[model samples]
Target: MVLKYCLLLFTTLQFIQARKVVDLTHTYDKDVPKYPLGWLGLENFTYFKMDTLAAQFIDEMWIAFKKIEYYEHQGTHIDAPIHFGSGRQTLEEIPPERLIGPGVVIDIRNKVTNNSDYAVTVQDILDHEDEYERIPPNAIVSLNSGWAQKYPNANLIFGTENTSDPTTFHFPGWSVEACEMLLQERQVSVLGVDTPSTDPAQPPIYPCHIYLQTNNVPLLEYIANLDSIPPRGTTIVLGAPKVRGGTGGPTRIFALIDDDQEQEITSNSASRNFMSAIFAFMYLNVFRFC
Candidate 1:
């Protein structure tokens, strides 16, 4: 009996390890797009800088290191509630459990193609639920505007050659009403977007950021690889840094997808058969133990 239980546990662990992990974070570097400095009323600002700290040959191996400096929100990052809401949770204060949840990708690429300034509406959410299922509590809802393809190019990504001018910027974002429904009705934990801001570029007030952050919901911006994951069923894990008093910081996001779901997406029959065999073996082991 003891051996049977151990084998079952081992198999279960293997099954879990088989799940595909899609990295949803973009590579951070000096070239990544930065929020417009002009919008902050600053003429010049170094958003990201790097310097070589050490580069030498150790006793037997090469030793190299560098120092990096950048604003917390420069790259793919988390916007802690404190970013927009005074006295709210900071990066360190946010609960770890809140950083992980079921991922829901609401695709608005079609609408975005027609209008770069499109904002996700409540009806879009309703239509998503009609096709899929209701947005679950504590879910991480992300908007896929297909904006990531233009990343690293400030002009294209921001939809304006004058990247520093907020007035000329154009990008899709979440509408206040849609965010309100997710917070009030679905109780979602995180709101993510491929764009730089949670609110449309034309809206100087940033209603979505103010409203959602005040309600203690964090935001994930500049998320990459949304097109790589399924619309639903995957788990999103946000590896946010624990910076004391930080309003936001660069984050490493990952999508944990089940093997079956991955197989369905790829349509790999061999992988499907392998998963089925694993399940059959586990069932047989249970029967043998009983």
Candidate 2:
């Protein structure tokens, strides 16, 4: 009986651990792509720097620490509503509920293969909805342009060797119409992209940024590994820093995927129930032996 209980508990633990977590964030460092400050006349300016502050023995133990500095929006980061809007939620002010939701990825890699400035259109959203079910309310809708392959490469990612020139850069992003539909119709909680910005590299005006931010929807940019998760089933969790008054900051995003479709065991309630059943069985077995 004891062996049987141990085996059952081990099986239950394995089932609970079967869910896979896919990281959707890029590693932050000086090498990560950043907006060019040359347009603002700050040529050759470094936005990120890390230096070893301490590397010595402390209380018979070796200790080391590094001092790091970077722009709030650098690397895989969240752009809080205040990034573009005048009086919107700051980084720390964003509600925790808004940072987590179902994930939906709209792939536009084919369209973006040749045209660097391609924008995800409203029709794309409609087509995605037609294929998958209607996007759930508070979904984190992400645009997958296959741009994450060019990560840490300033020239290839931006479509220009002159990284300092914004006008010369090119990339794919979300269109205003698509963003509007997601905001107004589907009531999405967050917008995400695998590119550096939510807007195309060379837009006349940052329409998506302005409109979405004004409406108080946070944006996730420079996201990585969109190819790893499914379009609609996974749940997205954004690990954004609670920086007071910050416009934006680096974020660690993850997608939790249920590999076993038949079992449908990824839901929190179901997992709790399954664990409870295992515990109940063990308790009943112990009482019988007692």
Candidate 3:
């Protein structure tokens, strides 16, 4: 009886340990969409790739090598506080522990579909909290505007007829009040969005960027597949290049769902423990009665 109980417990724990990971990053290539104005408000990104397989095919091994280059801020990337200006933490300065946390997806797809320049307001955050508990401390809040489906077309993604003037573009972003509430009041670790930036494209002043940058809160931009993440109860893991003294760089972000959340392993720990107790009781009762 004891041996059987032990095996059952082990199996139950192993089953519960299985987790579901969802890729929330967009692939970067020559055709990847860019932030129209680019880093310095100049031309778009420059990505180059060279395959040297034929050139180095002398030996029987036939080794192949590829060289690639692109801007750190381009594609799905994180914007370090230093990107704004001096006296801030660089990409490397951010602690590795802050890169991962509970994920919260505040969906604004309805508002965005109606108004392209709609900004996520403080009331929206409050409404979300009222519906689904409060945003936990140090959680990573992601703004899902359903913009990931509009990729490959730079014009449509940025909502601009021309790329010369960035001010003409339109997209949903976090308002300054919302940023302050999340940063100062709620104390969230990271702000991620499906849009190209954290602030509205036509804002006279990028208050959202200033609020986050000054507070040392990392900003994730151009994130993809946010629709896959639940409003809560998901863990996010971020992987990015550690560039020394760098302002920002591309990042690979994903979310993890536990067995209970994914409904993969229905047998919980408590259930298994109760079963073990019942088995032991039955075994003892049978022997005593016999």
Best by TM-score, which number?
Answer: 1
lDDT of 2 by residue, 177-280 (tens): 99999999999999999998899987635899999999999999999999877787888999999999999999999988865531353334665567668667
Give the TM-scores of the predictions, in the order they appear: 0.90, 0.85, 0.81
Estimate candidate 1's alpha-carbon lDDT, on a 0 to 1 scale: 0.89
For model 1, the superposed segments whose C-alpha errors exceed 4 Å read 1-9, 16-18, 272-290
Among residues 3 or more apart in sequence or in different chains, the pairs in candidate 1 whose N, CA or C atoms overlap within 3 Å are: none
Error of 2 at 53 (Å): 1.8
How would you order the candidates by lDDT, starting with the best? Answer: 1, 2, 3
List the lowest-lDDT window of 10 residues for candidate 3: 47-56
> Judged by lDDT, which candidate is best?
1
After superposition, which runs of candidate 3 have C-alpha atoms over 4 Å from their true positions? 1-17, 38-41, 44-62, 264-290
Q: Tell me the tens digit of each residue's lDDT in model 3 across 1-290.
A: 76676667556655545466789988877777665455456764465354454445565666666666776677788988887746888988988878999999999999987798888999999999999999999999999999889875788887887755677788888998899989888889999899888887776357888878887888999999887767888899989668898888889998887656655334446654655676577557643443
Model 3 residue 4 lDDT?
71
**Candidates 1 and 2 compared by lDDT, better number:** 1
